[model samples]
Target: RSNKRLVPNIVEPKIRTIEETVPMADRTMEEILQEPTKGYGEAIVILEILAENFEIKTNLLQLVQTNKFHGFERDNPHTHISNFKRMATTLKYRDVPNDAIKLMLFLYSIEGAARIWYEKKPPNSILTWDDLVNKFVNQFFPPSKTTHLKNEISRFTQRFEDTSGEAWEHFKEMLRACPHHGFSELNQIDTFYNGLNEQDQDSLNAAAGGNLLSKTTREALKIIEKNHKFVIQEANRMFLG
Candidate 1:
């Protein structure tokens, strides 16, 4: 399910120095907007140099190539067209600064490129652009019904809308001591869902209106529900006993 693109290793090309690579602030507004493709190329070159110097493992070349203002077709013709569409759509949603959105765009771009690269394979066999988008959307926004309980908890916390200093201090302490902990833990459920065996969790995920629950959380929820019901039934039996 990885969407990372493969980039070839090559010696770093000597071009502009890092300091000189920065975009100039003196340019006119129009010139600033159209500041030649050279600036973009130089920025990418500097990035490659820095990545190499730090031994950072990444597909910097693919990013540079894809981000460039040029038309370079892949071995498969359809891949070129699809990549263009994916890149355009990505720019459309670039306003949101959330990490989820960033990761989704990056993954979608890579997946789109991959789809083009693997277009010659069997009809049913490769990952497509639609698949990438579906996976990302499902990961970030689970079904309404499935997320109801978590939403309830969030609403409950927000009910005490006290902006006062003492209220803030008490709230912070309550947060620190709460068993469920911070708002971040709720987001981690998606990450946790990704770690489970796909077959075991996919069904429950579908039932919940897409695979929103992480495998661990899903399993824990099931166990708690079962145990609670069993305890209640056992208590009734004890009364009869």
Candidate 2:
């Protein structure tokens, strides 16, 4: 049936001048917020890609957090807390967002029931970003929930048929919920790689030519995806024979 179908045209991407090149950093807060279709995990992936493509110089933690690009309201406290944690992952590298900017951006992003707390701030009373974070954390995250998320992270393993991207995304979502403080990058990479379906783990290992712990997670994912495609094609050929 596929052989009888017409082949689709390969539309080439248009070339753009430097002046026409709008980096993700320059994207409007609303635009960034809308880019993610699979919730916070996908948003983190988008930010990581944007940061790499734009040669971003700012501390990643600050860049992600200070952007204030979440698309939900205050009633979604769980989401806001997750966003904070997603951004916090960069802190392990000794980076942080500017406190004032982070605070203002966070306040502006609030909606629904969450707005009242910010709106009713005492005229002369001062509140630090930490205070706001604590309030939200207590209300949404809580100690028990955080522990459960950490356990989930430890137990997460990719199914045999799952793609590397899908497995990594699930791991990231778990990370956002867990308390990843003091976790080493090497350890994180190992944990993520080990969770992959066994076939994908072997594919990544072969593509990286060993010592994959030194490679960035993004690079590893690309290699695994390419290898997975090759495996699928080889399988199809065998089945046809």
Q: Which stretches of candidate 2 lie over 4 Å from their true place?
A: 1-126, 177-182, 210-241
* lDDT (CA) per prediction: 0.36, 0.49
Write down the TM-score of every candidate: 0.18, 0.42
lDDT (tens digit, per residue) of candidate 2 on 154-173? 66788676666667666766
Clashes of each: 2, 1
Model 2 / residue 25 / CA error / Å: 52
- Model 1 is weakest, by summed lDDT over 10 consecutive residues, at 41-50
lDDT of 1 by residue, 1-241 (tens): 3333222122332333434434466556677556343332221111112223322123533453464322132232233334445544433222222222222233223344343332223222213345534443343233542355345434333123432222224333433333233356444334333333454245446544554453456564564344335545776789999
* lDDT, model 2, position 103: 41
Each prediction's RMSD over C-alphas, in Å, is 20.5, 19.7
